[model samples]
Each structure stands twice: as C-alpha cells, then as structure tokens.
Target: MKVAALLIADPEGPDPCRLVHGAPLLRHAVAGLLASGCADRLVVAVPKSALGDCEVIIRAVPGAGSRCRVLACGADRAESARLALDAAGESADVVLVHDVARPFVPPATVRAVAEAVLAGAEAIVPVLPVTDTVKLVSGGVIESTSDRDRLRVVQTPVGYRPDVLGKVCARGSDPLSDLPGSVRTVAGHPTALRLTTAFDVAVAEALLEEQG
Candidate 1:
C-alpha cells in the first residue's frame, strides 16, 4: 500500500531544531522512513520561511535526500499538511501523518498501523500505556483515580486512509492544535517519541540508541 508522511515544521528554527534536538530529531524520522522503504513515496513540508533550513538538512545527508519533497506551506499546521496532501496527488490507499518532534517512530509500529488499515479499519492510532496514576480534578477537588490501562498515552505516526484525512481537512480548517483528545488520538504513532521540550528530546535520544 502507498503511504505518505507529512512533517509540520515551524521553519523558523524553533527549539526542536537546536543542536540538542532539532537536527537529530529530523534525522531520526527521515532515516526511519528511508530504511522502512514501506511507503511508495515520503515527503516533508516546512513553511516557506524554513525552506532554506530544510535544504541545509538535505545537504548534510549522504544520499541525494530528494525522496522528501519539502515545501513552503501556510502559517498554520493543518494548512501546511493539507498543502502537502495536495502536492502528494496520488491519494495513496493509506496516509501516515508524523511530526518532526516525534522522531522515534519504530518501523514495527509503522507496520502495525498499516496492518490495521489493511485489516479494514479506516483509521488507526498508536498509543503507549500510561505508567503514572492519574487524578481527575474537578472544581479543585480530586474526583477520582483513572485506570491507566483504559487510558493510553497516544503517540504520533497515526495512520489514516488518505481520503478520510483529506475529507476531515475539507470539513474544517487544516487540523490545528488544541484538538480534542479523540482528535489527538487519531494522530499518534504507537512507537512515537515526541520531542516537545529539552527533556523529551533527551529521552528520545536515549530510546533511539537503544533501538539502534
């Protein structure tokens, strides 16, 4: 099955790009996709402002690195992603959306999501089990404890049928931040390692080494 990966890059050289995490993070994602050779095509989109930066990334890689077609997209995340979809053109049987911050997406997880879709599920999301007990706070009072098993910590590389994702984008604005939990769930990869802050990046780096 054909698959596409959309990387929503800030392009302004955000903290994710700093020496600590940025370059390594993108490298991790691209390397995995390249190695997987799972998708017929894989592409990355950065804001027009960040095109130069992405180019620098390609230049550093040993291969031609042209497999990932980078683009200068709109200001918003959904817009940029939707633009990538438009450019991808083929509307592959399945489409996988990933974030640069989540550089540690395992190839196994990628295969799992694809399996799910091929198994007839329209959408599939990857999530890790939460280790910490969660407290539900209501009106400043502890409501109750939550079952960690029932609650999964969603990760990125969420797989969806291209048509489904495109339709969702058409119904509303490009998928943006502050989406509902369910919406977020649809966007996680089972083996995803999100790099939001400095600490997250370090954890991801450690995980990558272990994975390697």
Candidate 2:
C-alpha cells in the first residue's frame, strides 16, 4: 500500500522549529518516515512560498534527498490532506496522514493504521483511552462529570479508505471541535506524541533519544 506522511513543513501553530531553523532533530522527522519503509512513495507538503527552503532541507537530509515530493499545503488540515489525496491518485488503496512535528510517529504505528485500513475498516484512527476525570462546565458551575471509560483522545495517523475521507471532506469543514465518530473508527493508539509546547518538544526529544 502506498503511504504518505502528510505533514506541514511549517505548521500553522507558533512553536517554531519546524526544522526550518535547522534543529538537530528536524531531519529526524523524515528519518521517522523512512522507518516505515513500506510507503511505495513519500511526499512532504510545504507552503508554496517555502519551496526553496524545502529544496534545501531535502538535499540536506541524506536518504530523503530523492524520496520526497513537495506539494502545496492549504490553510487548514483538511485542505492540506485534500491536496495529498489528489496526489495519491485513484489506486491508492490506503492513505496514512500524519504530522511532521510529532517526529515520533513510529513506523509500527503507521503500519498498524495501514493494516486497519486494509482490513476493511472504513476509518482507522489511533486513540488513547481518556485517563483523567472529565468534567462538563457551563459558565462557572460544573454540569456533569463525563465517564472516562466512554471517552478517548484520538490521535493520528488517522487512516481512511480513500472514498471515506473524500466523503467526510465533501461535507465541508468538520463542525465539531473534537473528531466525530461519523468520520472514523479507532485504529488503536500508537506512539503519537504531539509537539505544541517547549515541554512537549522536550518530551519528544527524550523519546527520540531513547529510540537511538
């Protein structure tokens, strides 16, 4: 199955170091993708404005020099993915969408999500079971406490059958803040570590160091 690690060379968020500044682990994100080894092809989505920087990055990253393609990433996640799906073509049996900033998206995780998609699951998403007590508050008062067992924090490489993803996007932007069930099913949680803050980056660095 062909796989794409649909990542934004520069994510919209403001933590920086999208590897744009040449952090030691920036290229390591591509290395993570190479671990998949299963993707018949690899592509990196960069802002149309950053092609030159992307070119330099690819050339600098050893094995990635000839393996990745640059596509236009849109303002939103779904749009960026739409561009990727279009590039994957009609024969792409399963598509794996992941974040580059995570850098820790394990190849095993990619393979697991892909396997779930190939297994005829309409949508495959990795989700961590909620570990904290959830509470609902309206204004200043607590309304109700949510059951932890009934909830999950979904993570990516949210995989999908090409058609299913198309259908969800066709409905226009997702209405809910949280991922809705209508879009997919849980594919089992993998090492989906998100990097949004300095602490997160630190955690990711430790995870990478351990992998070494």
Candidate 3:
C-alpha cells in the first residue's frame, strides 16, 4: 500500500521552527517520518509565512529530496489537513495526519499506524491509557468524578484510507471525529506527547538529554 503522511504546522500555534535538540521541531518531525519508512510520500503544510523556511528545513533532512513536499497550510486545522490531503493526491492508498509539534513521536508508532491502515482498519489512532484521576468541572465547581480506566489520551499520526479521509475533508469535518467507518486504536508511546507550552518544550529537551 502506498502511504502518505501529512505534517501540519499551524501559523496560530507555537513556532514549529523553534529549535529543539539542536534542530527545528518541524525538522525533527519530517526526519522522524522519513526514518520510519511508513510513507511513500510526505506532504508538509506550514504557515504561509514559513513556507520557504520549512522547505529549507525539510530539504536539509537526508533522503527527503524527492519524497517530501512543503506547502502553505490553511487557516484552521481541518482546512490545513484538507489542503495536505489534496496535495497527497489520488496515488496514495493510505493517509496519515500528524501534528508537527509532536516531534518525538516514535518511528515504531508511525509504522504501526500505517500498518494498521494497510491491514484493513478504516481509521486508526494511537492512544495511551489515561493515568490521571478524572473530574467533571462546571465553571468553578467540581461536578462529579468519572472513571479514568475507560478514558484514553489520543495521539497522532492518525491513519485513514485515502478515500475515507478525502470524504471527511471535503465535508470540512474533523478527521478524528466519528466517521462512516470504525476508528481503531493501537498502543501509543509516551514520546508522542504533543508539545505546546514552554513546560512541554522543557520536558522534550530533558527527554532528549536523557536519551543522549
């Protein structure tokens, strides 16, 4: 199966070009995907202003020359995803959408998501079991306590068949939402944590140092 991965870097979000572990976070994501060998093609959607910078970053990754394409993303996440899907084209049988912010996503997780799509799963998402206590808060008051065992924290490189994703995108629907087909889950790695705040960046840097 021909797999295509979409890496999105929203303009409104934290700077994807921010250096982490001696390389831009976006570069890390692109390199990780390339290292995984799960996709036949890689389509990166970045902020309009960062197009040229992103192109340079992607080009710097070894073995990314022909397989990677960088383009300006849409205003919102769904639109950005749709634009990337369009860029991925009809040749790709499976599509995986991932956040560029989650630069430490394990290559094994990437391969697993793609493999599940190849195996017959209509839609796939890697998820980690929620370990924190659950609480329902309304305004400032705690409403109730819920079960955490049934909860799962969703992670990316979400996989889908090309046609299914196309239809979802065409309708402007979130790909992670309920779709026409069943969405299956696979084991997620802690390294796949989505980076958002400065604290998250600090944690990622700490992880990198520990690994080295």
The estimated TM-scores of all candidates read 0.81, 0.81, 0.95
Predicted model with the maximum lDDT? 3
lDDT of 2 by residue, 11-75 (tens): 47422236422363346566666776756556666667766666566667667755577776777
Write candidate 3's Cα lDDT for 38-69 as tens digits.
Answer: 77899999999888888888899998999989
Model 3 vs. true fold: TM: 0.95
> Which has the greatest TM-score?
3
Superposing all C-alpha atoms, what RMSD in Å does each candidate have to the true structure? 3.6, 3.3, 1.5
**C-alpha lDDT of all candidate models, in order:** 0.64, 0.63, 0.87
Ordered from best to worst TM-score, the candidate numbers read 3, 1, 2
Best first by lDDT, ranked: 3, 1, 2
**Over 4 Å off in model 2, which ranges?**
9-11, 14-26, 62-66, 174-191, 210-212
Model 1 TM-score is: 0.81
Looking at model 1, report the run of 10 residues with the lowest lDDT sum.
Answer: 178-187
Each candidate: how many clashes?
Answer: 9, 1, 0
- State the displacement of the C-alpha of residue 132, model 2, in Å, after optimal TM-score superposition: 1.5
1 or 3, which is superior by TM-score?
3
